[model samples]
Target chain A: MKIALFGNPNTGKSSMFNLLTGLRQQVSNFPGVTIEKRIGTFKIGDQKHQLTDFPGTYSIYPHSLDEEIVSQVVTNPTHEDFPELAIVVVDSSNLERNMLLFTQLYDLKIPLVLVLNMWDIAEKNGIKIDISALEFLFPGTPIITMNARIGLGKERLFAAISTTNKAQELSPFYDGFFPSPIEDKDAQKQEIQDRYEKLRTILPSIQGKKSSVKSTFSRKLDAIIIHRFWGYFIFSAVLLIIFQFIFAFATLPMDWIEHLFITLSAWLSGALPDGVLNNLLTQGILPGIAGVLMFIPQIALLFFFIALLEESGYLSRVVFIMDRLMRPFGLNGKSIVPLMSSVACAIPGIMATRTISDWKERLITIIIAPLMSCSARIPVYTLLIALVIPKTYVFGFISLQGLVLFALYSLGLVAALLLALVLKKFIRSKNNGFLIMEMPEYKKPRWSNIMISITEKIKVFVWDAGKVILAISIILWVLAAYGPSDSMSSKIRAIKETSLYIKSTEPQKETMIASAKLEGSFIGITGKYIEPIISPLGYDWKIGISLISSFAAREVFVGSLSTIHAVHDENERHENLQTHLKEARRSDGTPVYSLATGASLMVFYVFAMQCMATLAVVKKETKSWRWPFIQLVIMGIMAYVGALITYLILT
Target chain B: MIQEIAVVLLLILSLAYLCYRLNRKFFSSGKGCDTCAFSEKGKIEHLN
Candidate 1:
């Protein structure tokens, strides 16, 4: 038997689903829509049952895309996922409001098992529920008390499920509440109001409160956290702390990973015989893998804080506070979550726009979301910031490097809002967006959930981004290692015999030879071809190569550069790539990565639509090539203009 | 000479494997967002 799990948002439905399925859940889309369908299986005695967790909705009358999905599947008997049984998860502390949906489902004639979740919270709030009385009021439906967060009331829920019979007709309780085959809009509204009135009359019989007060602590916390004046201040402080934490916590692990990879590369290069296999291991594969792995600490830390903020329910308060502020930019409050999620990665951020009911707001949100500097941009930013920004203390406390990082992030955000304002004028959206979010009560962050989220995000980064980086590295290494047969060998030999090379130290001679060979290689030719186009933005032929290769992924910029520089310097094979970049000089005897060039590169990365993965996701989400193409062109122009301006100003 | 041939063949195989993985990730259907492991399957339909 297939069981459909439905609930209003934030009713512990996900917790119950997690409890039932553990790690056995599979997430897919509903047949033709982007709404996620999560399916899991569990055994009841000798029989296995499938549980489908539908997107949460307030009432069966759909207002949003997610809600429409629930209404469509539940009402259509011919639907592929029509359920044999439905479990309506509800918050016990807020039974009155939650029962509104239950009554609607009851009228729809769907058999349901009421899972009153957060029963512990209800009891602590001095609210008492008469489960048997409530069951009596809605005949044939079973009510199970549950505190899913702590894994309580599972056996009882299962027992209730076992004994419950699937009802094929509407319950007697819904007889007078709904009009049969209601067609008139005005009449439908009257009918809903009448049902609520009836529910209000019956509420006292099934629910009793020792005191009228509930959620005093949440209320007290919200007073300050959501205060108009102090809320922004608190949020700013929170963001500052999070950035500081990311830098402080991730530096050691990043250093260790970098050291480990360098040592491994050095060892492999020495141990293996001089051949393509050895070169592939040390030059092509290891550095690429290291580049992806090195950023895991920062990525993991960012997701860790985000997951904590979300799990603690503070994020919703941020949405609540920022809604009015976002409205003038043509985005609604609901766009905040997706935009924030974009900071971790834009793909998920774009996917998260599903919750917005207004099509125009959601579309604008998707279009501008990539402007938020995602974790993929972190590697590029860190490389440039470390190269150019002085690590001095500001105001005797703030690190200048951190401030530059903060400025880059802020630049992305300010650009996103400003662009949204412009897009708002052009995109013809008639729908007026409104926010109807529930602020979930604050609670201690669930360590298990946090760990799972961090692990999953890190795994995705390594495997998804890792594969592309690895491929690019291998292909690039081959191109950089072998050039046109005659010119490459001749150039190397000529450089080795030069009077300048003969007078230099052993390390300098090795460097000279490696540099000469690279210049004659195929990859070098390609870079030189594109150097004219990128030189205006303060990039040389080598940086040109990285800029082109990294379009596959922004983080790949660091990996590609590391691979190119590593392959060229045998003496500095184990030296840090940053050091090599710092010492590199242009044709005019200035450092390749001077402050002007570094700042220009950072600016370019900030505005560029560089990630093919993001474009692919945008293509899927919008289901058209038109939007992604426009995005690419517009962002490309912005990047060029922005970088050129920065370079000129700094130089 | 045999050892050199063997090493070249290994490099070719590795490159081939990488191409296959890249193709699967980028071109395959029902896998939304190649960058996110937890991304849902199926392309989003245009909102009417």
Candidate 2:
């Protein structure tokens, strides 16, 4: 039997869901992991059920993404999977504000059970809820007072689910959904407001105290974090540390993966018999693909920290602080969360854009979202940082490499805001509301929750993004592996027959040459197709292929380069891929990955909307492919122009 | 098979225990949730 658990923000609806389902829950991306949904399952009396924990919102009258999603789930009849039972959970402590939603759900009159979660919080604050009185107020339903945060008061919830009879049908509160043409919409809204005031008059009779209690610590922290001057300074400093760590500390692990892949590729070439098929699979495919996969550690680690910050109740603070600065750019403080989270990946970040209600602001937020230096850009950035940004120590304290990495991240953020401001000229923003957020009380983060969140993110990354990337990498390898020609085989033979100077120390020179010859022969031709286009962007034919392949994912470029270099049978002797890249030259013997070219590539990846998954999500969230298409064209032009300027200025 | 059955049996046991706890709080109490005094302490500190 299908049952839907729906509720408002801070209503303990999620807490109840956790109690009911326990661990039998999986979060799936609405498309893939990045634009995912949380679905949990539980059974009551041998009747197993699925519960989709939709994003919490205040009303069915939509404002943000969360509200729209819940509104669709509550009102829509055309959806194939409609709920047989709808359980509306509310906060009992503030019945007046809480009743605003309860009345609407009551109007719907589906088989309903009312759960007052955090009932414990209500009683402590000296609030008395007359359960029978509330039941009398809203007829034909079971009312249960429960504390879902702990195990207390949950069984009656399950029983209410299992055994509740159909609720008595209540007449529509409004003649229709708001803004009716027949009557003045404003007057109808006032009438609804008057009814809410009438209910408020009797609420005190059910409560022990005149008012419910709110946490003061959250209020104090919100003040400091959201303070105008101090807030921006703290935000900039925190961002600086995060970028510095990614550049300095993440490099060791990155280098290890690089060496591991190089060794594996060289070993595979040596062991496999010298054949066209072996050459295609081992060197051409494996190394090119490994570059994309190797970034999981850095990207996963970045998300792990973000998840921790969110769980610790600090991410909301960052948004609160940035709201003032970002507001002028057609975004409110709430838009900052999506922009910051987009740094991990754009799907969640774009979905997070639902927090913005104004359509103009929401569109602007979605458009600029891809510009935040997401972790996908890190691979592209890291490669450039290693090549162009010199390894010099600044004041014997900071690494120059780290400084450049930090600058790149800062540039991306600056560019995002600038673009958003430019877009403001075209968009008409309807922002009126002040920043209202439930600053979740600062509790020492539950380790278990952080772990679960990280695990969920990684699972989405590996299973969803991973699957698409892996398949695409193999296809790219094939394209680079075999063209519709026999020139590739002869090229391999020719390279082997000519080169006299051999390194005796490394045992597998012949296999490497044959593999390298195959790569240059077929994929070389393919990469050359777009070489002229990207050549001005400071990339050669090999880079051109990687760049084109990277349209599937930006991280794949690193892998494509890895494959190209490792094909020459070079192994762990080079500390990193940068050494091989440094030695690489053009047809006339000039260095290919010059300082200008490398910088241009980094700028391109920063602004380019490359992830197909992110595009799919934008299409899904915006409810049209129109937005994603516009995002692609606009960002593509910005990236090309930005890269062109950088290359031109330097060269 | 024994291990599988045991795992299933344990899962059932967990559900039954959760049901017992939920039922006691919801059916019998018929009062405010914070009346328990356990979660009330957090609320007291939170108010400050």
Candidate 3:
């Protein structure tokens, strides 16, 4: 059997799916969390069934692309995903609004088992739903009250599912409404009003309430949290504290991990015979993996705070307040969701634009979405900030490095807004976008869910990104290790003829030879080819090489630098990447990572479209090669010009 | 000599794997976002 779960947004529909299917699809305390259909399998008795959790929608009438997906699957019986039965999950505490979706689905004539999820919440709010009365009103429908959060009513749900084997010959809520498709907008509005009127008549008979009133905690908090000025202030303060904690709390673990990798690399280099394999492991693979793993503490910390804000329903308030700011930039409040999601990665963020109804707003959001700094940029940002920015505190407590990290994130946001203004002038749409979203009742953050989300995020970051980093590291190692015979021998001969090389000791000569070999290597030659173009932006050939390689993925920049530096400074085998970069110098003996160069490079990364994954997603979403090509050209120009201006100002 | 040849083979294999992944991520059409790092974690099954 194929069963489909449907409900209004934030109605615990996905929570019920997770309970039954034993899959951890992301269930947050906000709407539009499930932008894609999540499919999983579960067994009932001897029979196994596939269950799909669709994006939440309000009615059979589609408003946005996500809702259109639901309408298409349900209205067309011949569709492959058309379910044998449907589970209409509704919030029992707010039964009136939720029942609109149920009535619409009921008239579709599909077999459904009405699930009043969040039953405990209803009871706690002094509201009681008479199940037998609801059953009598919609005869042959098995009504089950459930608290899906804790699996309180799973057994009854299973029993109800088992009994609903066939569609009942129940009376339609509106007899003649369906046969003639209500094509006119006025007719659709009239039909919806009629349904609500009927629901009002039936609600008194089925619902009973106690003397105690519903809680107003969420309303009380919203007064301050969503206040025009204080809301922005509190949000900024919260972000500042989060960055502070990430740096302060993660330092010990990050240092330990860095130390461990360095010690391991050193031991391996000595323990093994000095050969090609030894060099491959110590110089290539270990450094790359180490560069990625050392930042695990920071990544985990960042996701930890994000999960809390999301699960506690605070993120919805951020979206609510940010809507006012977003409207002037050719975007509406709904654009905030995709923009916020892009902070984790832009691929899903672009996919989330399906929730936006206006074509122009959606297109504008997709174009500017990647400018939001993502987790992939975290390693790049943190590494450069540490290398250039002072670690001294500003207010006697705030770490300067953390403040710079926050500023880089804000820079991305500001750049995104500015570009959206420019794109808005070009793109045109007649329909105005409206954000009709629910303010889900705030609740305590669930620790178990937060831990699971963080673990899964870490796993994805390591495994998916690790594979690419390791592969590129190997190729880079091979390129840096050798060169053409003519080029290599000529460099070696030229270096040996110098008085400095002639007068140097044996160890010094070996170090000099290694440096000469790296400069003449294949990768070096390639980097030098682009050096002139990037030199005005304060980048050397080495930085140019990292810039080229990191196009595979933004995080690969750190790995590339680690591998390249490892090969260049063979004598400093025990030093970590940060120390190696700190001591690097130009041919003029000036510091390679001076403030001007570091700031310029960081600004470049802020504007660059470096992630191939993001490009692929934009291509898939827009269904045109033209948009992605334009995006690439626009961002490339932005990166070069932005970096050049920053270098000039700083120098 | 054997170790050097083995290292060289491994390098070639790595390059081949990268090429294959890049092609599949960009050119191939599929149900999911093929290049997305978070896709494996998200477990999205596009109904289309």
| Native-referenced DockQ of model 2 | 0.01
> lDDT tens string, model 1, A187-302?
66776677778878888777786323548899999999999889988987787777767776787898999999989888888887777777777877787788788888888888
Q: Pairing residues by index, what is the TM-score of model 2? A: 0.78
Q: Which has the better lDDT: candidate 2, or candidate 3?
A: 3
Backbone clash pairs in model 2 (N, Cα, C under 3 Å; residues 3+ apart or in different chains), count: 12
- Candidate DockQ values, in order, are 0.27, 0.01, 0.46
Best by TM-score: 3
TM-score: the better of candidates 2 and 3: 3
Best by lDDT: 3
Q: How many residue pairs clash in all the candidates, one count each?
A: 0, 12, 0
Say which prediction, candidate 1 or candidate 2, comes out ahead on DockQ: 1
**Model 2 per-residue lDDT tens digits across residues A265-320:** 66876786666545555655566556665666666667666766766677767766
What local lDDT does model 2 show for residue A585?
A: 76
**What C-alpha RMSD does candidate 1 show over the true interface residues after superposing them?**
5.4
Question: What's model 3's lDDT at A533?
Answer: 100
